[model samples]
Target: LDRNATMKTRLTTLTWRGSASVDPRFSAAMLPWSIADIRNHESYVTLSVGVEDGVLAAYNTDFELQFEHKLRYILGYCRVIVKQEKGKKNADFLMPKATSTRPQPITIGNDNVAEIFGPEFGLVYLLKNPHDPLLHIHFYECEKYEQVGWVSFLIKAMELGKCKPSRH
Candidate 1:
């Protein structure tokens, strides 16, 4: 075999075996068994849209969805306040003003609070920022966050081959 092909085979063989130096008890979850088949150059994996939706539902709670809905509602009517300074250049630029409609108090659902899984942060429910996709708020334990779930652009991450477990 050529040098590149030989190196690839060796790497795949080593990855198929559990680590030599580490005990199984100390390790976290193992890579899904499909990794072996997926390593083949001609291999392809097919996932159904319904299965994808179901998995998303399993990780998301009703409260969290409601929270996102309310935030979206408030932001829909939001506008930036631009005050013109006396001596500033381009101070006359027109800006959107807040709606005249009275602002009502937003009452969120019970899931508005974080579910504590540990002494400090056991579970982590992330709220994604509307303006920035990469930013999010963690609701539960920082150390044990993944025990609950993670917020990520799964499709984007997988497309870029960057979807490994972040903490581990």
Candidate 2:
């Protein structure tokens, strides 16, 4: 496991100001190792580019609130796996097939994820075709962590920006 994946990846400092600016608290309180470990799970996803980490919700989307008027649903962990015994090229990444009737797997193409967002906990992942680098999303459930992280991330962004943002 790469250690950086576990640590927080955000930070605020003169050196860090050039990248995208989200809440900096996420970067500050995190131990470097915890952010690093995340790479093995999620954070490797890069599509056409310009995509933010959280998937946007929509109108009547009972999951997240995207618009002031429309309902929004947030996107969570989406992974591609391969199954070893499935007789497919990347069979090992697949979730096991049921011996009898069971809930079917949720497998979607890479480009279509943005269109479909569902209850993160209720979502299921199945086998991926296993390329050298597959996109993965890791959803962390600690709002406390997010609150702390965002606060830290912002604080650092301000300080680094020379705005000298202060919280009391």
Candidate 3:
């Protein structure tokens, strides 16, 4: 049995499911995570990222607008996991399979940055910057994936220019 395969199966088992009612209190608590704040170019986006034992995980909610002209809303969770390799000073990212029926092991090394973006859930950028020496993650919520993609592209372009100094 492959290690990555086993890890993927284990992660799928940790799926969270539940239901709740809409209330003004709940809405008030989540207002900070709204797409409007991201659109306004907020300086900081708050997300929960933590490490326990040998596993590092980040979790966030994706708001999906439904019904006619965004009258209704649905919520889903996106989780990213990275497991430390035994005896090695590197970790492997665990990418979730698109569907529950198929189990595919997709893992990336720590050196490579991993990002997940969706039309509903927003974007998660995972990277370690040398200047900070800590895990740097930038999350942005958008009603449409196109908006996230556009911003991501611009950020990447700017980063490239900064790295090369003459590529602009």
Give the TM-scores of the predictions, in the order they appear: 0.17, 0.19, 0.28
Q: Score each candidate by Cα lDDT.
A: 0.22, 0.24, 0.30
Q: What is the lDDT of residue 62 in candidate 2?
A: 25
lDDT of 1 at 165: 24
Better of 2 and 3 by lDDT: 3
lDDT of 1: 0.22
Pitting candidate 1 against candidate 3, the one with the higher TM-score is 3
1-168 in candidate 2: lDDT tens per residue? 432232223321110001121222332122122223432344322111011122111112122222221001211223222323355343122232335566224334333321112211111111122331332222221112233233223323432463332232
Q: Look at candidate 3 and tell me the lDDT of residue 63.
A: 18
Quote the positional error of residue 163 for candidate 3 in Å: 13
Model 3 misplacement above 4 A: 1-119, 156-168
Query: What TM-score quantifies how close candidate 3 is to the native fold?
Result: 0.28
Task: Write model 3 residue lDDT over 1-115, tens digit each, in one string.
Answer: 3433212211111111111223323322232233233334534433222222223233332311111111011122222332234744222233435446663433232323233
Residue 56 accuracy (lDDT) in model 2: 19
Top of the candidates by TM-score: 3
TM-score, prediction 2: 0.19
Candidate 3 lDDT (Cα, 0 to 1):
0.30
Model 2, CA-based lDDT: 0.24
